[model samples]
Target: MSTAVTRLFIPRDTTALAMGADRLAREIAAEADKRGETVEIIRNGSRGMFWLEPLIEVETPAGRIAYGPVDSQAIDSLFDQGLLQGETSHPLCQGLTEAIPYLQKQQRLTFARAGITDPVSLDDYQQLDGFNGLKKALQMDGQAIVDEVKASGLRGRGGAAFPTGIKWQTVLDAVSPKQQKYIVCNADEGDSGTFADRMVMEADPYMLIEGMTIAGLAVGADQGYIYLRSEYPVAHQILNEAIDKAEAAGFLGDNILDSGKAFHLEVRLGAKAYICGEETSLLESLEGKRGMVRAKPPLPAIVGLFGQPTIVNNVLSLAAVPYILSKGGQAYADYGMGRSLGTLPFQLAGNIKRGGLIELAFGVTLRELLEEYGGGTFTGRPMRAVQVGGPLCAYLPESQWDTPMDYESFQAVGAALGHGGIVVFDDTVDMSAQARFSMEFCVAESCGKCTPCRIGSTRGVEVIDRIRNDEDREANMELLEDLCETMIYGSLCAMGGMTPFPVQSAVKHFPEDFNQPAQTNGAQS
Candidate 1:
């Protein structure tokens, strides 16, 4: 008689890797061999709960049982506790992986398959309805696919909040001079406190591939490029592997699924420039030029890659297409409130007790995310400020915490939900210094394509330093505000344009912080 092989799942995500998942996996396998046990170890993607990372799961008759925040040293202890039999008595055991409240509450449309299957397994993906969207797309014409997307109420997830269907419609209507259109996935996610894009690429890469394929079919584009950030080496490697596997499995290449349509995809690494996160700068980088923003008149949809029409969409926006096509557009659109349809994968990071990814409908308040999911500050101190979007966004005070997390609500509050990254700060933080850092970040990251972004950021940093030092503080404060105004209206791109958001918000909300001298070392003056 044969015995069933004990199957264990370990995360191969970047966060899990940093938390020693690799070492723990090796230890578990060695311990199993020593005990004469037949164990099959499968490396899966993260569930996005970083607090319980290095999370290991044991496959059982009921379901997959989870244990987490595990270290290599726990391997012996885990085995002795009948981990293979899915024992729950162990201190580390976290019950059924699916039942965990953190995961159970999420409306995981784009990330549905994440952490549940082997990332590179084509067979596993197929069984989980992976290519169903692409299969459906093959049966529909380009107009029908675009119409479905239009009905979904999908907007750009890459900070801009632009209508995604409108952009696609323009590309579909455009007539490329060379008869060549391209689909470009702007994966250069450089915002602070943002890792959702990396999670998608590393955890469920085929979702992105399938999304891009559907986009190609929709826009009559044959070539696609993922302009990925150079910092994510793991994502880059995984994406390439997934692309290759997809081609071999008849999901991509000269003829997809024996259909007459064709789409070829590849990943090109950026030069570590923050500016390339903008669509035009990414196009320039992909064309082997220096990463710099191009002025708009001939939009990328009309004159794009190699002077041909193109469809440029963010990682999250494209990743949502598979779900939209599979379940129908209105089904995906039924989640969020108001015009902000569908769920957004909000990344909770910085000083917080339980920080991870929270995918919810758009109507949820920042207070709910910060308190319920984030569990307040990590230091257990009073939460002071929350910086949504990225470095270029406003540092929101507690009074504004109740604002809903959709595009219009945030905009109405003089803030923009750029990339859904929320960075929390404890009471010890200095808002004046934070305001200064915003200007400094702009000076360092601006591509120098325009004057206001280049020179204004440099002058703004100097003016902020003057105000912090109490050198003509009142005069410098007014001067700083005026300079911020110039940058806001004069800059060519959001890089220079939105630099004032943090600075202006800080001065407006925390006026007392600027009245005193800046903190020295770790002490406030």
Candidate 2:
């Protein structure tokens, strides 16, 4: 490898970019030019440590030294402190990157290469065991590949914790001389507190590409589509560029490394409809139709995109494929507990200190995540409630903080580990208002295809208003509970079905918020 006179690592993730990483990058280059120094700048992804965005790293003989929350204004001072030489005396110096507690604590399986390499560089990706999984997969028959994933105990990282191997097997078995098969990667990551999908697409695009390629080989698919959200412009550009690189490098397209297997991939932008995050709705949107939820019985596995056999997976799920194929399924399964095997990229957001992505094995307690990784609330006040999963997940009170981050554990408490997102709320939050907001959110984002979610949510808002206004308080409360139950069992999809999770959870956990008579805005009951 050619030695650089000096090397700098700055993140281009949307979070970092929003924090002025782009401006800081330009300033660092200008400072180096003025000093007549040769510097190599590499734009890597964030290590999921959000509070320290615009995190700068300098490659040294000892290791990579880090500095964080840096802006253009700090470049001159950082350079003055001999940052290029790896000096740790600067105020912003964070010592070694890996040694950071937040990062060191994470069991980064899917995100192993994130924040560590040039995202689009094929050679850099290959040097880090990137394509080993694809290579191993190429040597195995389709049944062997499917069997390995089945043995891994890998469930969907997407909201539905369905068995991934079973989905692949159905697609594999559905294929015949006349049937076409496809693989779809759900990159429409709209869940609150979730950025794991966008991170993989932007930081290590090749990992996702390799994973999808393996899926193609396993299920007899020749075409794949990544349905990415339009909000992620940076990921869109990076993924498109990565797809081009992969196609040119023979990792994708008609022939795969001269193996005579065809796996062509493309990125399709979502219509910015939250409902499209659901698989059938996403398929409907992909076909140039209005985004609406579809009824089941003809599952997407058997009748998906263009009415063909398909495998629909989340970005995080597909990204894990490379590692599983490389090190064996059992090795990947060894990390977590119970049916929830393997690591999950759990995102910490909202009113939390040190909020970032924390990917760990299943079974970590919520208390540990909220206190240890989150460092409690950002405002330093006592935390009152936390919404695990996403906007529709149950609003867990502090009493339920001991719940483990596993499918069955969460299910036992009438909660879920949907998308592994944890959004915290401080004690000052009003659960009454929050309950109403859940209804409003569901009404706004609902696809109008289901009656329970569409009409029930509007009624839910009215019931909450009645309870807050003390209009037949006990009766309205009963009506509200009845409405939630109806939505949970009657809706066509989670949009209507799961909205009650947050509504009821708030009422169940913080009864005081709904028990009081009407009061002036912002007044404590």
Candidate 3:
């Protein structure tokens, strides 16, 4: 191995691509050639610190010095500044990539492979502890692997913090399937405040593939499918490439790792429907049907894609599998506090400075996350509420600042550490408008499979309007409360069910907005 090669790390994830990393990479390469530099640039998946996209790292005598959010215009300056030789004088430079507290503090397990190796090069992935878990899993009985996961306390990172071990155990105990058992990755990350899925897919594609392979081996699954959302076009492109590479390298094809496991994988995409983020809706889309959610009781594990025993796990949840398998479950599980286990990949977004992915053990308070890590509101305005979770998640006011970001603790305060996403809203934001938008968003995205979600969402908007219009604001508030109760009790999935949480929280937190007098021009004829 050429250990002395001048290594340059560039992000290739969707967010970085959206921020134009592709053009920047080409510029860096071209500039390197002009300067006669032997630059060995590696297009790795992002470190998930999205605020610093197009982040470039050049191996220096001191260490891997970093530069970020770089555009093509800065490439020439970067070359002139001796970036390949790592002088660290560029305008975009952020010295020592690893030293950034945001990236350093993260307990990166699922993200272990991310930003550490070439995303497409299976060899680089293998060099950095990739596929080792799958190999280790193949050595043991599948049941033993499942038991290890159960012990690790790794839960679903896609909103609901359900124990992964319990889900796997249930699937294992269900049957000794010699049939078409499937492993499905839910990559439909439509939630407004979350991009962890997109980052992982783009930054560490093979890690996800390897994680899926382990899940397949443990669950007797011979086929796997990833239901990627259509909005993540770049992620889809990268994942497709990774899958091909994995197959070529004998990691995802027939007799994968020569363990007699015939696991094959493919990708499916949803048509940008938010409801598709829900597992059932995702399965329906994966099965070549309309992305409508299926009623549960006959859960996806029992009757999943095309009527088979499927292991449907969120992208992060599945990605976290390798870590637990490589270093036993109890070892992974012993990280978090209370019922929450392991590290939470908290996605910080919206109206906040230092917005990016922050993965830490659960129990970090909202106040610390918002005021300290978030660096207050991006607008420099005082913050009013921190919407933890997704759009449906509750808008926790400043009063709830002390609430720790655990599932149960959040639930106690009419909130949730949903998918570990925290979207900050400044005081200037109109809560009534946000509440109305929540209802409107629900109406637009509802799968229409459930009555409350379909009709109640449309009605919720009008009810919110009634409160805003001062048509007996208190009475309208009561009506909206009734509507919330109906939606909470009646909706099929959490999409419609939890929409009320944010709406009501916003209204309760900012009551002045609901009672604001309608501004009318006197000259309106």
Candidate 4:
């Protein structure tokens, strides 16, 4: 008689870790051992459904069944409930993992392997069609790979929406030794409502490794670095593990796959500077300098990282390359609306029922995400406004919920999709307070490299305070608008350039909030 080993999956993603998944995992293993049962526990990444984290899954003949928000004390009960046999009688039983509506709705191109495979497991990643893109890339020349990315219409997912292929082509075209050129990934995902980058790094680090390898091959660079945010300790550990594993497997470093191609990748922690999210500023931080913005013209594509031509891409943008190369660029291009092609991993945060990640084609309406996926505000109050693309983006009211989640469409509405982060706010939210907070955030986070962002943000906050206190309300309003215009065009980078978005949007959409008496804690009345 053959004894079967029960397979159990637990997430080690940061959110799950914060929810005590590590303790739950150890407890589950202890209980299984105490019961004289054989169990194979695998630590996977979060499913992006954060509310259901510590989500445990068991492999059954039928499929993987899920039970979530599992507590350490519940481990014995789960085992007693025949969890190894995939029993569905437990109160936390969520049935088939894939059937969860929140996950089912996402297109998940860039995040295809997240939450499914063991994070840092080279074997598991390979089994799931992982390096097919790198294999395909190995068979093609540099121009061919760049052309493929261009055909896919992939823009930088870090918020700029600049064509990624064009950036690669610049580095490819620059007159520099292959060794001098570099590939830098901006993993400093500090924006509010954003964790897609963190999830990708923690869940499927190899996908990023493979993608960065492809970028190196295409851009004639053999070295790469991921400037990750220091806040994500879990991601740092997972990425380092994946890198070591990949190097040992010959998928990274020194003659990869014995194909005579060589690429090396490493992770460097950012100084927790929000301005470092900018391409040039990130380059500065990567070189051990203070994180600050650099002037354009000699763009990062021309001079970056050690003053060599570099290809800087966001984590999601690099993560998308494997899919584009494997499935063919046209397949990805066919998914989204005009101009913005391929999938975008939209993060739902703030006051929302289902706050997690949703990767979809670019044209989905905000109303669908808010009403259907998010299920409205977590406070159970009506959603007053939604901030699309982080704190630097505009505060969109309910009236603008129909706007499409695309670069051009968002721009058409006088907003920029800084990053695919949507922060929902309830009716009790004060747009005026939010506007002030935007300036305050900029004030605190600014690199102090430019006057408009460093100084203008301070003045903007004071102006909002005056308006809130009803001191020269009308005149201050006009002055605030003028100041915003200067910051929008005068600031060195998006840190100051985009800070006015929330301020402008607030005054435009919810003027009544500004006129009302200031509430305690500096919130709206």
Residue 218 in model 2: shift from native, Å?
Answer: 0.6
| Clashing pairs in model 2, backbone N/Cα/C closer than 3 A | none
Best candidate according to TM-score: 1
- Count the clashes in each prediction: 0, 0, 2, 1
Per-candidate TM vs. native? 0.98, 0.97, 0.95, 0.97
Alpha-carbon local distance difference test for all models: 0.92, 0.90, 0.82, 0.90
Error of 1 at 271 (Å): 1.4
- Best-to-worst lDDT order: 1, 2, 4, 3
Give the Cα error of residue 206 in candidate 2, in Å. 0.9
Residue 438 Cα positional deviation in candidate 1, in Å, after optimal superposition = 1.0
TM-score of 1: 0.98
**What lDDT would candidate 2 get against the real structure?**
0.90
| Weakest 10 consecutive residues of candidate 2 by summed lDDT | 516-525
Model 2 RMSD, rounded to 1 decimal: 1.7
Task: Name every residue pair that clashes in candidate 1.
Answer: none
Candidate 1: worst-modelled 10 consecutive residues by lDDT? 516-525
Model 3, stretches more than 4 Å misplaced? 1-5, 176-178, 518-525
For model 1 the local lDDT of residue 267 reads 96
Query: Per-residue CA lDDT of candidate 1, range 120-196, in tens?
Result: 99988889989999999999999999999999999999999888999999999999888999999999999999999
* Residue 190 local lDDT, model 3: 82
Better structure of 1 and 4 per TM-score: 1
